[model samples]
Every structure is written in C-alpha cells, then in structure tokens.
Target chain A: MHIVVCIKQVPDSAQIRVHPVTNTIMRQGVPTIINPYDLFALEEALRLRDKMGGKVTVLTMGPPMADESLRKALGLGADAAVLLTDRFFAGSDTLATSYALAAGIRKIGEEEPVDIVFTGKQTIDGDTAQVGPGIAKRLGLNQLTYVAAIRSLDLENRSIVVERRAEGGVQVLSTGLPCLITMLEGTNTLRRGAMDDMFRASRATIATWSAQQAGVDDIALCGLRGSPTVVKKVFAPQPRKEKAKMVETAGKSDAEIAQATLDTLFSANPKLETDLRKLAAAS
Target chain B: AKKELSEHFKTYKDVWVFIEMERGKVHTVSWELLGEGRKLADKLGVQLAAVILGPPGNDLKQAISDAWSYGADLAYVVSEPLLKDYRNEPYSKALTDLVNTHKPEILLLGASTLGRDLAGSVATTLKTGLTADCTELAIDDDRCLAATRPTFGGTLLCTIFTLNFRPQMATIRPRVMAMPERRDAKPGRVIEFKLSMVEDDIVTKILDFVPDTSTEEAHLAYADIVVAGGLGMGNPGNFRLITDLAAVLGAEYGGSRPTIQKGWISADRQIGQTGKTIRPKLYIAAGISGAIQHRVGVEGADMILAINTDANAPIFEFAHYGLVGDATRILPALTKAFEARLAVRRMAS
Candidate 1:
C-alpha cells in the first residue's frame, strides 16, 4: 500500500507582527513551521505505515522555502517528499487549492497508486476546512474530516474504519480504500527525526512541478483565476465601543475583592445574576 | 447592491435568517438570531424573515409560527423529501435560488457546523461578502450592517462592511446573542417553495449522522461561568487547575486556541474565533495573552476576569477584572477558595 500526506508551511502565526509604519503584515525574519495541525495527520500516517507496512510519501505545495518543511516531514520518517510550487499556484483559494493538489496527487499516482491521502482538518491561516472536501469532490476520493481515531483498517478487504468528530458527537464510519482523510489535532504525537534522516531530508531533491508538469491543463483553474472566492481585502478589526470597567482592589482581601467584582459584574448585566443563580443550583 | 455582488444579490431586499432545524429538532440558536434579526430588520425598516428548509409534512408550519413569535415578519420554506437531510450541493442551490428570487438586504445564519458549511458555499456561489463567527452585529451610522469579529489570532476586534453589497451576509456563533422573550406569540406569513431537484441529483448521501462523543462538551458559549487556562499554566497536565475551579463553581473549563494548537487539548475544548463562541456569566481567563482571534471567540461572555503575569497582556484591555499575578499561583488559590465556598454550601444543603 502507498500512503500520501499533504503538508504545507505556514508562518508561525504566534510570531507574526504587523509592520508599524505601513500596517502591513511583516513576513520578513518570521520563522515558518509545519502547520501544527498537519503534524497530527503525518504522525497518524506514520503509525499506520508501521502497523501495515506501507511507504509514506509527504507532499507539499508552497514556495521554494517550503522545502524546509518537506524535509522536516521526511526527517520524521516520510519515505519521499514532493514539492509543487509555481508562480501560477499563487492566490489560490480553497477551491483552486484543491484543484492544484488533486492534479499533483494524480502525478504521484502515475508513479504508484496511492491507497490513502491524509491532510490536516484545516489550515490555521485559511481556517475554512473546505479544501479537503473540495479535493475529495474533484478527485472522487472518499472524504473523511475530523477523524479522531482509526478504529480498524482491513487492507485485504480494501476497507478502513474511523471515528469522525461531528458537531455534537463522533461517527463510527467505514469506507473503501483510496480515500482522503483529514485527522483531528491532539490525537497523536509526531515522531522525532534522527540526524541521518534529517540530512537526507535536507539533501533530498524535492520533485518540483509546474502547473503543466503536475498535469493541470487549465492554467485558469490552477490558481487565483480558478478560485471562485477572492479575499478582496484583509484589515484590522474595529475597536470596542467602550473599554471594560476595571474593578480596582489594590488592598482588599481576596474574598472581599471577589465579592466586590461579582457585585459590579452583576450590576452591569442583570442576566448574569440569573445565570449565576442557575450555576449555583447546578453546583 | 455592490458592483461585484452576485446578480441574485441585486434582487435581495430584506433580512432573513435560515432557521436551522436538524433531526426534527429546532436549533435554539435560531431564536437568538431572531432577536438580533429583529434589530437589523428594524434598522433597515424592512421585514425580518426566516427560510425554513426541511422535509415535507413535518409540521414545519409550527416552526413558522414559532418564528413569528420570535420576531420574524415572514417565513419562506422549501419543504420536500429531498430536503429531509442536509446535502451541501442541493441545499446550497436551494438557498441561492431563494436569495435570487426574493432580494433580502441581509442574511443571517447560526455559525453552526451545518451553517458554516452551507454559508461558505452560498456566499461563494453568490459572490457576496461573508463574515464568519461574528461576535456583534449592529446597524452602523450609515445603516449598513457593521459586523464585528476578532481577527489577528484574537488580539484585536475588527468591524467589516460589505460597502455597496446587498444581502450582506454574516454568520454568528451559537449563543453569542441573547435569545429574547416571545411575548406576542403571533403568526408570520408562511410561503412554501416547491422543490424541483430529486434526491438522485444529490451525490453524497447521509449514510448516517455522527454526533460528538466527548463526555465533557464545551459549553463556553452559554455557560454562566467559565474558567479557561492558557500556555502560562505551563505543562498540559496543569489544566487540572482550570477544571478544579470550574468544578467548584459548576462552570465549564476551556483553554485558549494556543492550548489546542500546542496539543494540550482537543479542538473541541478550544476557545476562539474559529474554535467556539462562549458567552458565560463570568469568564476567568488564566495565562491567556488575549490575541484578537481568541478575543472574538470569548468577548460575548458577560464579564471577563484576566489573571496573568503580564499586566500588559491584551486580555486585560477588556477583561472586567484584572490581576497582575502568576496564573499558576493564583489559579490554585481560586480553586481552594471555591472549594471551601462549595463545601460550606454542600454542608448547608
């Protein structure tokens, strides 16, 4: 069996600072890391590989710098890495993104058929959680999102069972192989890459692909032009109408301050009084 | 309508909330939206309406009456067998078709799992503006919908406008707005829309409905009191400190988005713009730095209490109460105090 994991390099959102002068995002000197969510998907893939004995290939669509992340995935035990980066793939929304990724996966299939495709539930930056569905729709792959656990996998029968996290509960689902699964975060830990593996990842020649090379015939559908939705603008949020009323208690005792704070809070929002009564009863 | 909004949006004129009823049960968030829709509708001086899409012969008519009592001026429904279960393709096409025929100035949807899925596609198909997980919705000085939500990882608040777009779109997280009282209990106009698409046309089948399983569901949105921890608590194991305080107060315990990002908790336990909307009576944030994205998710809480080592942490800006102290130190103290108070109460009982 052949398994593929799609990873992307995302700017460490925690360290992203806004440029003071232009108010534009400052991307320079900011470190990039594997999308924290994607690591869960990669680790799950590696675990399945160890149990089932399948080769794991890590795939990424990013700038040239993204090779850094691909190598990191390889260091963590991905057997191969492929980077699909081209000027045309820029400005792709979820739809366009899925299209490009689907084409790249097809190219990988030409070398060897992929039994399972894995991805993170959603990207922190996009937060749309639509790309997995979009890719499944386009590639005709069975789509499973928010997978919490791998209940069972019968490779001989070409069937896999998973627990998918839904709105209110988990669904025990069984589907055929050749499927795309987006794993939920915090389910598993990523393995450490050894010094030798890290060197191979850093030195590996990441197969690069352009739109045509990746089998995407329609350039229009490959990137921004193909995307139906456009983020016309990204701006700062508006300020609140009023600042919070700070309850000052410099010298008061903890109990006294707590009482005063509760009183002031209830006075501002009377419903809070009723809510607290309800909580107290529940307690 | 804007020069770029979909042709369908050009014809939309009033405010409509897609009254979501899943599994023969009405989502309570619909009522909260009715309360808000009334304000947006009144501000626009037009009718407030609801779009009910469900299977036929389900007493959806009663759902219509409830909408009237809740504040809808009219209810448009597409009742058919194919509409029984929500399939993205069919539902998107149906709602898009409705917006085209009857132009509404504003469209509201509960920022729910189903709502988010449908709204993203519908907004794209219509090519209009959509703001997801909004904390506040109000009529601006110019009478346009000013959608306020947290951005930039929950550090700041931003208000978005569609400018010239009509049928302005927004999704509010569940429990963000207050559900008003239903006094009039009147009936609104009900118009039924016939479904032409057959089930065969739809590709994906329900197969089955899988509900969430975690024993502790995050009630951050509606909890009377919430105690949340952050990375400042240090290791993932220290989250027990947060739960201890919550246990004594009978409150829900949550973690900032970063906690989930750090694998300290599941996404279900995360609190922020994309995670969950919590409007508790009191929200005590421990060790949280208060990024804009995280702020958007929790600002609905009636009162915010911040306990962090940094006095300048953005969480303090809007928190109702502030303590410039170590959360690792203060959280334990809070837990003990609440435990003592609860013990006193239990003995009295």
Candidate 2:
C-alpha cells in the first residue's frame, strides 16, 4: 500500500485580524501552519500504513516556503515528502492546482505503484472542496468523499469500505482500490511524533520537483492561463449600522431581568409573539 | 482579447436546473434555483428547463409538474433504477450525457451534499468550470454567467466567470436564493432520456444507510428562529445552554465551526459557510465573535442578537442587538425569561 497525502500551508486564520480603521485583512504577524484539516489526513494515512505495511509520501504544491508543511508531515511519521514548486504554478486556481497535483502524483507513482491518495476535505483559506474531486477525475480514481471512517480495507482484494457522510444519514460504501479519499474533519485525533521521529524528519532529504520534473509539459495549462474562472473583485463585508438595544437589568434579579428583556423585545417587535404562537400551535 | 463562442458551442441554448429529489420530496433549493434560472433565461431570451433523474414513479411525475409551476418551460426526465440512489458514477454520467446531447447553455444545481458530489465529477468529466456555494448569480453585460461566492475564508466575495466553457455551471447553497411563488401553470414539455450504465458498472455501492439518531433533525435552513454558540462558550458543557434556550423558543440550535472541532457540537449543527446557511426570523448568537465564516451563514436572519463578553466582538457590528456579558450567565437568564413569558401568555389566554 503506497499512500500519497496532499497538504497545504495556510496562514493561521484565527490569528488573522481585520484592521480597525481600514477594515482590511491584516496579514502581518500571521504565522503559517500546515492546514489543520490536512493533519487529519496525514494521521489517517499513517494509521493505515501502520496496519498495512506501506510508505506514506506527503505532497504539496506551493511556493518554496510550503516545504515547511511537508516537513511537518514528515515529523508526524510520513515516510517521505515531495514539494512541487515553480513560478509557472503561481496564481493557479483550484483547477490548475489539481492539474499540477495530479501530474506530481503520476510522477510519484513511477517510483512505486500508488494505491491510494488522501487530501483534506478543504483548505481553510480557499474553503473549496473541489481539488480532491478534480484530482480524482483527472486520474480517473474512485472518489470517496466526506469519509467519516474506514470500516475495512482488503488489500488482497484491492478494495475498501468506508462510512461516507451524506445528508440525513451515513452511507456505508465499498469501492475498489487506487482511489482518492477526503477524510472529514475531527474524525480522528492526530498523533504527536516521538522524539526519534522528529530527528529523522529533520534529516530527511526532501524531494523538490519543478513543473517540468513533475510532468507538466504545457505551460499554458500550468498557471493563470489554465484557470477559466477569474475573480472579478474582492471586498470586505459592510457592517450594519445599528448597535444592540440593551435591556435595563438594573437592580433586577436573573428571573426579573429575563422577564424584562422579553417584555421589551415583544413590545418592540409584536409580530415575534404572534409567530412564536403560530409555531407553538403547529408543533 | 474579446472571444466569441465557438460555432459548435453557440448551438447550446436554454437554462437548466437539476431538480434534486430523494425518496419522494424535492429539495426546496432546486425550486429556488429555478426561480433564479428563470431570470437568467429571460435575460438571454431562452427557455428555462428542469432536469429530473430518479426511479420510475409518480414522484418523478409530480416533480416535473412542480418544476413547471416554479417556472420551467421544459422538463428532461431520466427514470432509471441506476440513478435511484444517486451513485456518483451513474448520475454524473447521465447528467453529462444529457448536457452533451441537449446542449444547455447554463446549468444550476443545489449545493447540497448530493449536488456537490455530482457537480464536481460532472464538471471535471466535461472539462468545464463550476463555482461552488455561490451566494449570487447573474448574467454580465457580455451575456456570460457571473457566479459570486465568498473566498479567502469568507473575508471577501469574488465573482467567477467561466469565459471559455460552453455550459456554465454553478451550485447555490440552500436559502441563498428566495423560493419562487408556485403558480398554476400548464405542464411542461417532457423529454425522456435513457442512461447507458447499469449496476454492474458502478464500482462503488451503497451497502447500508445509517439514519442519524439525534432528534435535532429540524431543517436548519428553514428554521424560524436559531440560537448558535461559539468558542466563547469556553467548553462543551456550556453548549447545553444554547439548546435549552432553543427549546423554550422552539428554535433550532447550532454552533460555530470551532465548537464542532472541539466536539461540543456535531458537524450538522455547525452554522457557517461550510455547514448550514440559515435565514431565520430571529437569531441569538452567544459567545460568538462572528468571523466572516459564521457571519455569512446567519447574516440573512431578519434580526440578529449577539451576546459576548468582549465589547468589540465582530458579531456586534452586524447584529441588531448586542449584550456585553458572559453567555454562561446570560443564556440561562434568557431561557428563563422566554419560558416565563410563554407560560404567562399561556395562562392569560
């Protein structure tokens, strides 16, 4: 079993603060972390490799700085890390990004027969869960998305069964191998690397592949030119002008305060009482 | 460079909305898209069509009539057993085959779980662009579809244009578009099609379906009132306050993404761009600092009341009402208040 997990380096969204005066994104002092979602994917891959002997290779496509993310995956017990970086891959949207990653995965397959590919359900920044399916389509791999758990994997039969999350229920699905899986978030807790694993990860020789090395032959299909959808504009959301109307709870107990607040709310918005009454009757 | 539609692509006409149905009922988002698609079709001087794929039954027939009432001029029906359960392979193949044969210029689908799963594969197989979770859709001056969605963690909105693609594709999240009035219109022209694939061809099979056990199955998108918590709740134990308040008000309860990550709430209860988009009459958010992700989900509420310890929580900026206090204490008080008020009203009546 040879598993390839795709990861990304993203600015810590929690730390990203909007400027007070300008209301613009404050990118300064925002540290980059290996996308938190991808950690779950890496952990799942490592668990699979531990059960069934195989090499887990981590792959990412970004600037040279993205190597840090790959190294972090290595520290978490992945066997190898590959970075696909080049100016040609810059300004790539999800489509172009999937194309580059697919090309990189094909090149990795030459070294060993790849059996499975893993990716986070989505990136925190892009918030688009398109790349995983796009890669699966490009490679013609069976896509098992929003997988909650791997019920079983029969390597001998080249098959696997997973619990896929869907609307209203969970579908127990079985599919063939050489497939792509995007594990849902919070499915498993990522493990901490042992002391020795961290040392080995620091010494690991990372493989760096340029666009040509990654088998991307068409220049037009590698960057902005390959992206059909263009973002016309970007702007901050406008704030509503009205501030909250505070309920005067002065010298009142919790119950009195609660009653007072409701009185004021109902008085100001009389329709609320009628709506709630109708809902109560219907229920 | 000004590009013209290729002669082969220029033949593509009509706007199509994929009517997402399961069991017997149609998803409301499908009707919402039809309402939006009708406008686009009218602007382009083309016909509006609805695509229905399900098992052969009266349910399919009812869906076709509902589509006409919602604004569809034509209906494309593919009744096959292979498409009954929505296996991605057969559905994508079937939808793609219909697109290739009929050549609809614009395609819209609900951004539900089934729609997202099918749209990705179909768009990729057809080598076209698909904008997911769109908040707005319109035809630009160039007669091209402009699909707008939040990007960069919902901080900014971006309009995506599929300039080179023949059949532009987009998925709109539920409640993003208002439902159109269902009119009493004549039945649409039905065009039946056949799917080539069979059960044996699909690699993936649904062995069993485990229904969710939790009783909080009220459709969050259509809820009348909502109460959501955020990381400010401090820990999982405090989430019960949200549910207690919701119980008194007959409102649905949810939380921010972090609450789901912390295992305080289930993914289904997450109120954000990634989870459920809600448009309730009254939304009470406690301990929520209101990130763009959470804001977009509840922004459509008719009235927003935010309670937080921090005076400068971003939620207060957009919220109609703000309370600068701890949610732990405030939630229980609010719950008791609403409960007492209701009890009094019941006694008086």
Candidate 3:
C-alpha cells in the first residue's frame, strides 16, 4: 500500500501580530510552521505505513520554501516528498488548489499506485475545508471527511471502515481504498523524528513540479483564472457596537461577580433562562 | 479598493446560490443563501436565482418552490437520479453547464460538507475565482459583490477582490445570517430541465460514505449554548473540566483550533475559523485564548463569556464577559451550579 499525505506550510498565525499602530501585517521575524494540522495527517499516514508496510510520500504546493515542510515530513519517517510549486500555482483559490494537488497526486500514482490520500481537515489560513473534497472530486476518489478514527482496514478486501462526524451523530462508514481521507484534528498524536530520521530528512531530495509536469493541461484552470468566487476586499472585522457591560460585584460579598454575571447574561437573553433550565434537565 | 478579477468579471449578470439538495430535500442552508442572495441581487440590480440539482420527481418541484419562497426570483432546476446522493461528478457538471449557458454575476453556497465539495469543483471547471467561508457580503458602490472573510489564519481579515471575474462566488457558514421570514402565501418562477445523464454515465460510483462518530460530538452549529475549551485547559486531562461543564449544561462542546491542534479535543469538536462556526445564544469559552480566528468563528454568539488565566489575553478584548481565573477551578464551579439547577428542575417535574 502507498499513502500520500498532502501538507502545507502556513505562517504561524498565532505569532503573527499586526503592528498595533500601523495595522500592517508584521511579516518580518514571524516564523512559519508546518501547518500543525498536516502533522496529524502525516502521523496517521506514517502510522498506517508502519502497520501496513508501505512508503509514505508527503506532498505540498507552495513556494520553494515549502520544501522545508516536505523535508520535515521526511524526517518523521515519510519515504518521499513532492513539492508542487510554480508561478502558475500562485494566488490559486481552493478550487485551483485542488486541481494542482490532484495532478501532483496523479503524478505520484504513475510512479506507484496510491492506495490512500490523507489531508488535514482544513488549512488554518484558508479555513476552507473545501480543498480536500475538491481534490477528491476532481480525482474521482472517495472522500472521507471529519474522520474521527479508522476503525479497521482490510487490505485484502481493499476496504477501510472509519467513524465520520456528521450533523447529528457519528456515521460509521466503510469504504474502499484508493480514497481520500481528511482526518479530524486532535484524533492522534504525531511523533517527533529520531536523530537518524532527522539527518536523513535534512539530506532528502524533494521532487518539484510545474503545471505541465504535474499534468495540468490548462493554465487557466490552475490559478486565479479558474476560481469562481472573487473576494473584492478583506478588512478587519467590525468591532462590537458596545463595550462589555462588566458585571460589578461592588459593595457586595466576594461572590457577587459570578452571581451578577449570570444575572446580566440571563436578563440580556430571556431564552437563556429556559436554556439553562433545559440544559439542567438534559444534564 | 482595487478589483481583484477586473479583466473578466463583466460577463457575469445574475446572483446564483447552489441549492444543495439530497434525497429530494433542499438543505436549509440553500434557502438561507437565497435569503442572503435576495439582498445581494437587490444590491446588484440582478435576479436572485437558485441552481437546483436533484433526481427528477416531486422533491425537485417542492425544492424549487421552497427556493421561490426564500426570495429567489428563479430556479434553474436540473433533474437526474445520479445527482441524488451528492457524488461530485453529476452535480459539478450540471452546475457548471448551467453557469456556462446562463452567466451569473455572483454565486453563493452554504459552507457545509456538501457545499464545500461541489462548489470547489464547479468553480475550477468554470475557471473563475471562488471565496470560501465569507462572513459578510454586500454590493459595493460599483455593484460588485464585496466578499468579507477572515484570512491569514484569522489573524487579520482580508477583503478579496475578484474585480473582473464573472460570477463572483462565496460560501457562507450556517446561522451567520438570520433566516429571513418566509412569506407563506408566496410563489415564484422555476425553470425545470432534465439533466441528460444517468448513473452509468458517471465515472465514480457512490461506493460508500464513512461517518465520524464521537459520543461527545455535539454538531455544535445549532446548539443554543456552546461550551468550548482552549489551550489554557492545561494538559489533555484537564479537557474533562470543559466536557464536565458542557455535559452539565447539556450543550454540545468544542475547543478552539489551538486546542484541537494540541490534541486535547477531536477536530470535530473544534470551534473556530478552520473548524466550525457556531452562533449559539450563549457561548462559554474556558481556558481559550481568543485569537482573531477563534473570535471570527464565535463572535456571532449573542453573548460570550470568556474565562482565561491571562488577564490581558486577547480573548477578553471582545468577549462580552471576562473572568480572570483558572478554568480548572471556574469550570467545576459552573458545572456544579448548572448541575444543581438541573436537579431542581428534574425534581420539580
């Protein structure tokens, strides 16, 4: 079995601070992290590789600097790394993104048929959980999203059963291999690389592909030209109209703040009283 | 101020929201977009339309009628059985074909699992710009759809401009916009057509759909009160404090994206920009640092109560109420309070 894990290099959004006065994104000195979500996917892929015995290829689409994320995946026991990078791939929306990535996965399939593909539920920056499904759609792969756990995998039958998150309850779905799985976050722990693996990762050669190399026939379908929605503008979220009405405990006992806060909350939303009641009964 | 897709946008003319349906029933979010689409259409001075793809039957007509009441001026109906269960092929093709034949000024979809899957593929096929998870949409003075969304990891918001692109597109999360009241005695126009395709013609079969199930998963989108944990919950063990409070409140629970990243909670329970956006009437955030991403996801809540150890944490800035205390201690107290209240109700009953 061959597993391909798609990873992305995202800016450390937590560390990114907008200059308090200027409002400009302070990019300088801000470090980039292998999107934390990708690690979970990579770890799941690696764990599968270890259990099932196969090579793990970590793939990404970003600038040349993205190779760092791919190498890090290699350090964590992945067998190969592929970087889908090109000017054509720049400014691609989730749609174009899926197209390029699907092509890359297709190319990897040419070398070795892939049995499974793993993606983080979504990217922190895009916050759009569309790409994984987009890739699954374009490639005609079964998409298992919001997956909690892989209950079992029967390689002989080419089937895997997984617990999927749905609107109401967990859906225990059993599907075939050669599919795409978007693992839910916090499902598993990603192991750190040992010294030997880290050294090998530092020296591993990464495969880089452009549009033609990745089997993309149309340039228009691979970038901003292909995305259907347009963002006319993005600005800071509007601030709330009123400042918080801090609950005051003044002149009362030490317990006043908590009680006062609850009072203010309930008074503001009459339904909350019923909700609290409903909540109590449910509990 | 600059248009992002200026060179190619003039060709689009109508506001189109994908009316996603399954097993003959149009999803609630479809109607939600129509309510939203009505506003955009009026702003753009265009017709508000819905692209309905489903199996041919009574369900399609009912779905189209539903769209009409939801403020859509027209319904572009493509009927086929293979399009029924939402395998990407038929739906994407049908929607793309409709877009090519009748150019639209904008497209809107619900940011659900099904919507996200189909929208991405159709947009790619049409070769146009697509924005995901838009929090707000409006027609600019130029009559262009201004798509406002969180970006750069939700650290800052970026307004994307597909300036010259036809059919500006965006997907909105559920409950972000209030559901407009439907006119019961209302009816509108629907154009019904048979999609010339079947299951055999489609390449990928609906081999199966595997579901993710966690007893703790609450599908928080519709929860009245959401109790979510954050990195401040300390170790993974401490997450139970949040769950205990949530269980006591009888609310679906989640954590900030950071908590999910920390492996303290499953991604299904993550409540943030990359996870789920909840508009519960009351949101109690425990030990979570309120970052822009987390804030954007939950700010829709009517009232937000934040409890974090750090007095200066960003969570306090926008949180409706702030309590500077250890969530470990505070959560237990809240749980006990709710538990006792619930007991009283049960005994009274």
Lowest-sum lDDT 10-residue window in model 3 chain A: A249-258
Model 2 chain A: lowest-lDDT 10 consecutive positions: A274-283
How well is each residue in A87-133 modelled by candidate 2, as lDDT tens digits? 99987877788899999999999999799999998888877788898
TM-score (all chains, Cα) for each model:
0.79, 0.94, 0.82
Candidate 1 vs candidate 2, lDDT winner: 2
Summarize candidate 3's per-residue lDDT along A131-225 as a digit string, tens digits: 88788877877777777788888889988888775444456666777789988777798898988999999998899888899888888877767
lDDT of residue B267 for candidate 1: 68
> Per the 3 Å backbone cut-off, how many clashing residue pairs does candidate 2 have?
2
lDDT of 3 by residue, B1-349 (tens): 2545454556668899898776556667777788888888887778888888887889987887777777888888887667767765677778877888888888898888777767767766665667778777888777877777777767677776566556677888877776777876366676766665676666444435543355555457768889988878878999888878777777888888777766677767778776677888789998888877788789889889988777788887888987777778767776766666567766786
DockQ, cand. 1 = 0.22
lDDT for model 3 comes to 0.78
Docking quality (DockQ) of candidate 2: 0.59
Write one digit per residue (lDDT tens) for candidate 1, span B1-349: 2236457545667889999877676777888998999988888888999899988764576678788889898999998777776656678778988887787788999877678667766765565567666778888776668887554454434566765556688888788889879868667778877766786665444555666566568455667788899999998988888888888678988888779878787767788766777877689999999877778777777678888777788887778777776667667776666555545555665
